[model samples]
Target: MDKTLRRWAPLFVVPALICFIIAFLVPMIMGLVLSFFKFSTVTDGVFVGWSNYKRIFTDMDFISSLWMNVRFTIVTVFTINIFAFFLALLLTRGVKGTNVYRTIFFMPNLIGGIVLGWIWLLIINGILLPKGVTIISDPKYGFWGLVALANWQNIGYMMVIYIAGIQTINRDLIEAAQIDGANSWIRLKSVILPSVMPAITICTFLTLTSGFKIFDQNLALTAGNPARKTEMLALNIYNTFYTRTNFEGVGQAKAVLFTILVAVIALTQLAATRQKEVEA
Candidate 1:
């Protein structure tokens, strides 16, 4: 049976492998190659060496967007995870109506990013309209507005993961700590936190990548208003690719850099968190 299964597994794997190659691997390789060329389309690419990348570095908008995204990612990563973890702790403590609350919290994540952005836009502007300003009136306003939207959309999803992690914890270990005269804070530090490290790792990676790749919300909410101050990396890449002429290669290059940045940051986070994860 084992030999037969092994033999037939390749037959099942081959189709998916082919699909992956055609759908992802091919396009990815093409994108990397195209980044070094000037072209409006894949077929017309003219070799331009590293000129596209050089343009990206010299572009002030790209630099500003990069820094803006960095700041946004940092703030969201810490804020989203902290709130999610606390909420997870609360819900896991035999709270009544927990299922209802969880559903309500997570429903926001089910909303489309564009739609969610518009929803928040109205809500935020309603508050600021009285002050004769709007979310797009100031870069700081847009920045914090994005932060709020991110937290609202992500916290519940992260909470669900945290709850799952918290549930997996050995009650015996917690009880042992309590019997050892460990206080709640100490038990959390020594046991609960370490036990949930896997969940923390997953949540952190998701938030980090999402923060960096954010586009639809950035577009719908601020549209990089106030002279493009709120533009993020993804939006910047989009504007470069579609809004500007003869800059497709530059946009593609920006995309490659963005991918590399996200990959490196996410991998580093995973490595750091995995080292601290305790056996459950």
Candidate 2:
């Protein structure tokens, strides 16, 4: 049976491989090619060869959006992970109604991003309206609004991963650490945290990537309002592609750059975290 399954493995893999090529690989290749050309449509492109790339930085909108996105990603990644880790620690203490608390915390993640955005929009606006201001009234408001939305939505999910990690820790090891006179902070720093490094790696990767690729929340929450000061990289690419005339190539170029940027940052984070896991 094992030999037969092994012999058919290639056959089983072929269909999914074909689908991947069709669904992702082909478009990525095409987008790369189109990024070098200027055209309103894919077939009509004329090779401009780096002109679109050259114009990317000259657009203030793109620059503002990129900067905002960087800040947003940094803020959300740290805030979400820290809050989630502490929440996990709290819930794992054999607390009463922990299951109920976990359910309530995690329910927010189940909501759709667009719906979450609009929900927070109303809540935020309701608070700010008394001051005669709205989320879009200022870029800082929108930036913090995004950070809060990201934290609220993602902390629960990351908490669950952390809980799983915390639970897997050997009870005997913890007891031994306590017997050796290790305090709570020392145990967390030396024993529990080291044991949970795998979960940390997973949670960090998810939050980092999600922070960078966020779109619907940014759209529904602020829509890059107040002269596009709150714009993020994804929405900026969208506006550049659809709103502008004769800038499709530039949008494609921006997309290629965005992909590379996210890929590099996420991979670096994974590598760093995984190395820590190994050392731990």
Candidate 3:
């Protein structure tokens, strides 16, 4: 039976392996090769050495957008996780109508990114209009606007994960802590928090990646108006690829850099958090 299963497993896996190679691996290798040359299409690629990479550093728009995304990610990851953790704590306390509240909170996550952006845009602009400023009128406004939207979209989802973590905790440990005369704050720190670290790690990773790669919301909300101050890395790469002529190679180079940045940051985060995760 084992021999037969092993033989058939390869047959089943071969189709998926072929699809993976054709759909993902090929395009990735082609893009990397294209980044070293000047070409609008793969067939017409002309080698230009490192010129494409050099241009990216000197481009102010790209630098600004990259910087903006970093700042936004820092803000959103912190706020979203903090709020989600608190909400998770609140809902786990035998609160009335918790299921209803959970459903309501998670509803925003169901909205499409573009539609969510437009919804927030109208609401934000309506408030700022009375103050004689708009989300696009100032870089700070745009920055905070993105932060708020990220928190709104992600907090509920993170809360659900946190709730799961909290539920899985050993009640015996919590009871023992209480019997030892531990206060609410002490128990929260020594018991609940350490137990929930896995959930925290997952939520932080999701928010970090989402914040960096966000495009639809950025597009529908600000569209990088007021001279592209609010543009993010994804939008910048997109504009470089489609909006410019004879710069497809440079755009491809920017994409490779973006991939490297996200990979490094995510791996670092995982390493840092995994070291602190306690066994359940």
Candidate 4:
């Protein structure tokens, strides 16, 4: 039976492998190739070498968008994880209606990003209208709006993961800490945190990547208004691709670079956090 199953495994895998190559691998390879060329279309592409890369760095909007995304990622990752962890801790306690509270918190994540963006747009505008400001009226407003939206959508999901992690911790370990003259703070710091380091690592990684790659929310919320001050790296690439008729190649180049940047950051974060998990 083992020999027969092993022989059939390659046949079962072949179709999925072919689909993967066609759906993802081919486009990815083509995108990489096209990044080095100047063209509005694949058929009309002209090999331009590093000029696209050069333009990406020289363009002030691209640089600004990149920095904005970095800032947003940093803020969102830290805030979301901290808030979620605390919420998870609270919910895991012997609180009434904890399941209902979890469901309520998580409902926002089930909403589509585009719908969420629009909903927040109206809600924020309603609040700011009284204050004589709007999300698109200024970059600062847009930035805060994005942060709020991200926190609302992601915190609950992260909380769920954290709750699972907290529950998995051995009850005796916590009891032992308590009996060892450890206060609540000490027990939390030395016992609970170390045991849940894996969950922290996972949550951090998810938030980092999601925050960096955010596009639909950025688009529907601000559309990079007020001279594109609120533009993020994803939106910048999109505008370069479709909005500017002559810069498709540059846009593709930006996308390729953005992909590389995200890959590097995510891998570094994972490696660092994984090391912490191992140590813990």
Candidates in order, TM-scores: namely 0.91, 0.92, 0.93, 0.94
What's the CA error at residue 153 for candidate 2, in Å?
0.5
**lDDT at residue 155 of model 2 (Cα atoms):** 97
Tens-digit per-residue lDDT, 1-280, candidate 1: 8887898987888999999999999999999999999999789999999999999989999999999999999999999999999999989878899999989988899988999899989988998998999887789989998999999999999999999999999989999999999999999999999888789888989998999999999999999887999999999999999999999999999999999998898789867776765433
Show model 4 residue runs off by greater than 4 Å.
1-11, 273-280
lDDT of 3 by residue, 1-280 (tens): 8887897987888999999999999999999999999998779999999999999999999999999999999999899999999999999988899999999888899888899889889888988998998888888887888888888998899999999999999999999999999999999999999889888888989999999999999999998876999999999999999999998999999999999999998898878776765433
Clashes of each: 0, 0, 0, 0
* Candidate 1 weakest lDDT stretch, 10 residues: 271-280
Pick by TM-score: 1 or 4, better one: 4
The order of the candidates by lDDT, greatest first, is: 2, 1, 3, 4
Off by over 4 Å in 3: 1-11, 273-280
* Candidate 2: residue 158 lDDT (0-100): 100
Candidates in order have lDDT scores of 0.93, 0.93, 0.92, 0.91
Candidates by TM-score, descending order: 4, 3, 2, 1
True-vs-predicted CA distance for residue 62, candidate 4, Å? 0.6
Model 2 residue 271 CA deviation (Å) reads: 3.0
**What digit string (tens of lDDT, one per residue) describes model 2 on residues 1-280?**
8887998988888999999999999989999999999999879999999999999989999999989998998888899999999999999989999999999999999999899999999988998988999998889888998999999999999999999999999999999999999999999999999889889888988998898899999999999997899999999999999999999999999999999999897789878987876876
Error of 3 at 178 (Å): 2.4
Per-residue lDDT of candidate 4, residues 1-280 (tens digit): 8888888987888999999999999989999999999888787889999999998888999999988999999999999999999999899887999999999988899988898899889988987998898777888889989999999999999999999999999999989988889998998899889888889878988998898899999999889887999899989999999999889889999999989989998889868987876776
Better of 3 and 4 by lDDT: 3
